[model samples]
Target: MGALGKENKDLTGVAIGISVLINVIGTFFFPRLLMVSGKEYGPAIIYGDYKNIWVYILSPILGAVSARILYKFLEVTKPAKPEPWHCNICNHNHLPFF
Candidate 1:
């Protein structure tokens, strides 16, 4: 999107936030909705067990949000002039091959 001149940082952040929310909801809620009530299956099925369900639900969201925060911090801290060869004092003869 940035290469195509459609760079909207706010939109990107919103999309990431929404996707994380949907993933958490689906992970914790979808399986229970699929199970049939009062029917005998091969074994008992459990969904959203209290022991670790919150961890499963929140970890992805926290990780993604933290990553975005880190990215934003790095973006703001990044130097405006990225090329080292632009400085005349540097001894480098030519730009390093990317």
Candidate 2:
């Protein structure tokens, strides 16, 4: 059990490290890509200018809508039936009382 716990902790740490690395890479690349595209609205977004009101307003709205759609899609696609818990002593499917 201790070994399993250590393995789980290591796995979690690796996942977090990978996530941070990806975010850092995206942070550097996404802005440069926007700048290269000659989109004036891009820099104005982080810098906060009056001209980028639409960008600021619409970004969260679109993000929320997309997130909701994705959540619903995942919920619908998930398996309908869940595996039942089994009692080891009796070898029967049943719920355990704590």
Candidate 3:
């Protein structure tokens, strides 16, 4: 016998848990891709709140500065650039998905 029954999880329960987790993250934490995220965060412009329009100008500058500061402070690792891809089956050296 095992020490506990907690290790076993049914497929449906695991799927549901993952679905809830993804939805929660997407709702609260995850920002969508570039243009979509910009549009989603554009309530000030969308709602005619021109008073707060400075957000469009300031956010990029502030975000860049904060990112640089965090990069220097945390010593974040950057991924290496991928080398030019050469497909074996296609017998071509062209870019992937192009």
Clashes of each: 0, 0, 0
RMSD list, candidates in order: 12.3, 10.5, 18.0
Compose the digit string of candidate 3's lDDT tens values, residues 1-75: 232133233343764576467556765653432322366356756787667456556756886697568545644
Candidate 2 per-residue C-alpha lDDT over 36-83 given as tens digits, one digit per residue, 9 for 90 to 100 = 223656567668875645654575578569756854553423245655
How would you encode candidate 1's per-residue C-alpha lDDT over 4-96 as one tens digit per residue?
123445456776787667666875866542222233222233543355344445655786798678656544332464454554676555554
TM-score, one value per model: 0.31, 0.35, 0.30
Q: Which residue pairs does candidate 2 place in steric collision? A: none
Candidate 2: deviation at residue 97, Å?
A: 21
Model 2: how large is the Cα RMSD against the reference?
10.5
Whole-model lDDT for model 1 versus the true structure?
Answer: 0.52
After superposition, the stretches of candidate 1 with alpha carbons farther than 4 Å from their true spots are 1-48, 76-98
Worst 10 residues of 2 by lDDT: 1-10
Rank candidates, lDDT, best first: 2, 3, 1
C-alpha lDDT values of all predictions? 0.52, 0.55, 0.55
Return the top candidate by lDDT: 2
Pairs that clash in candidate 3 = none
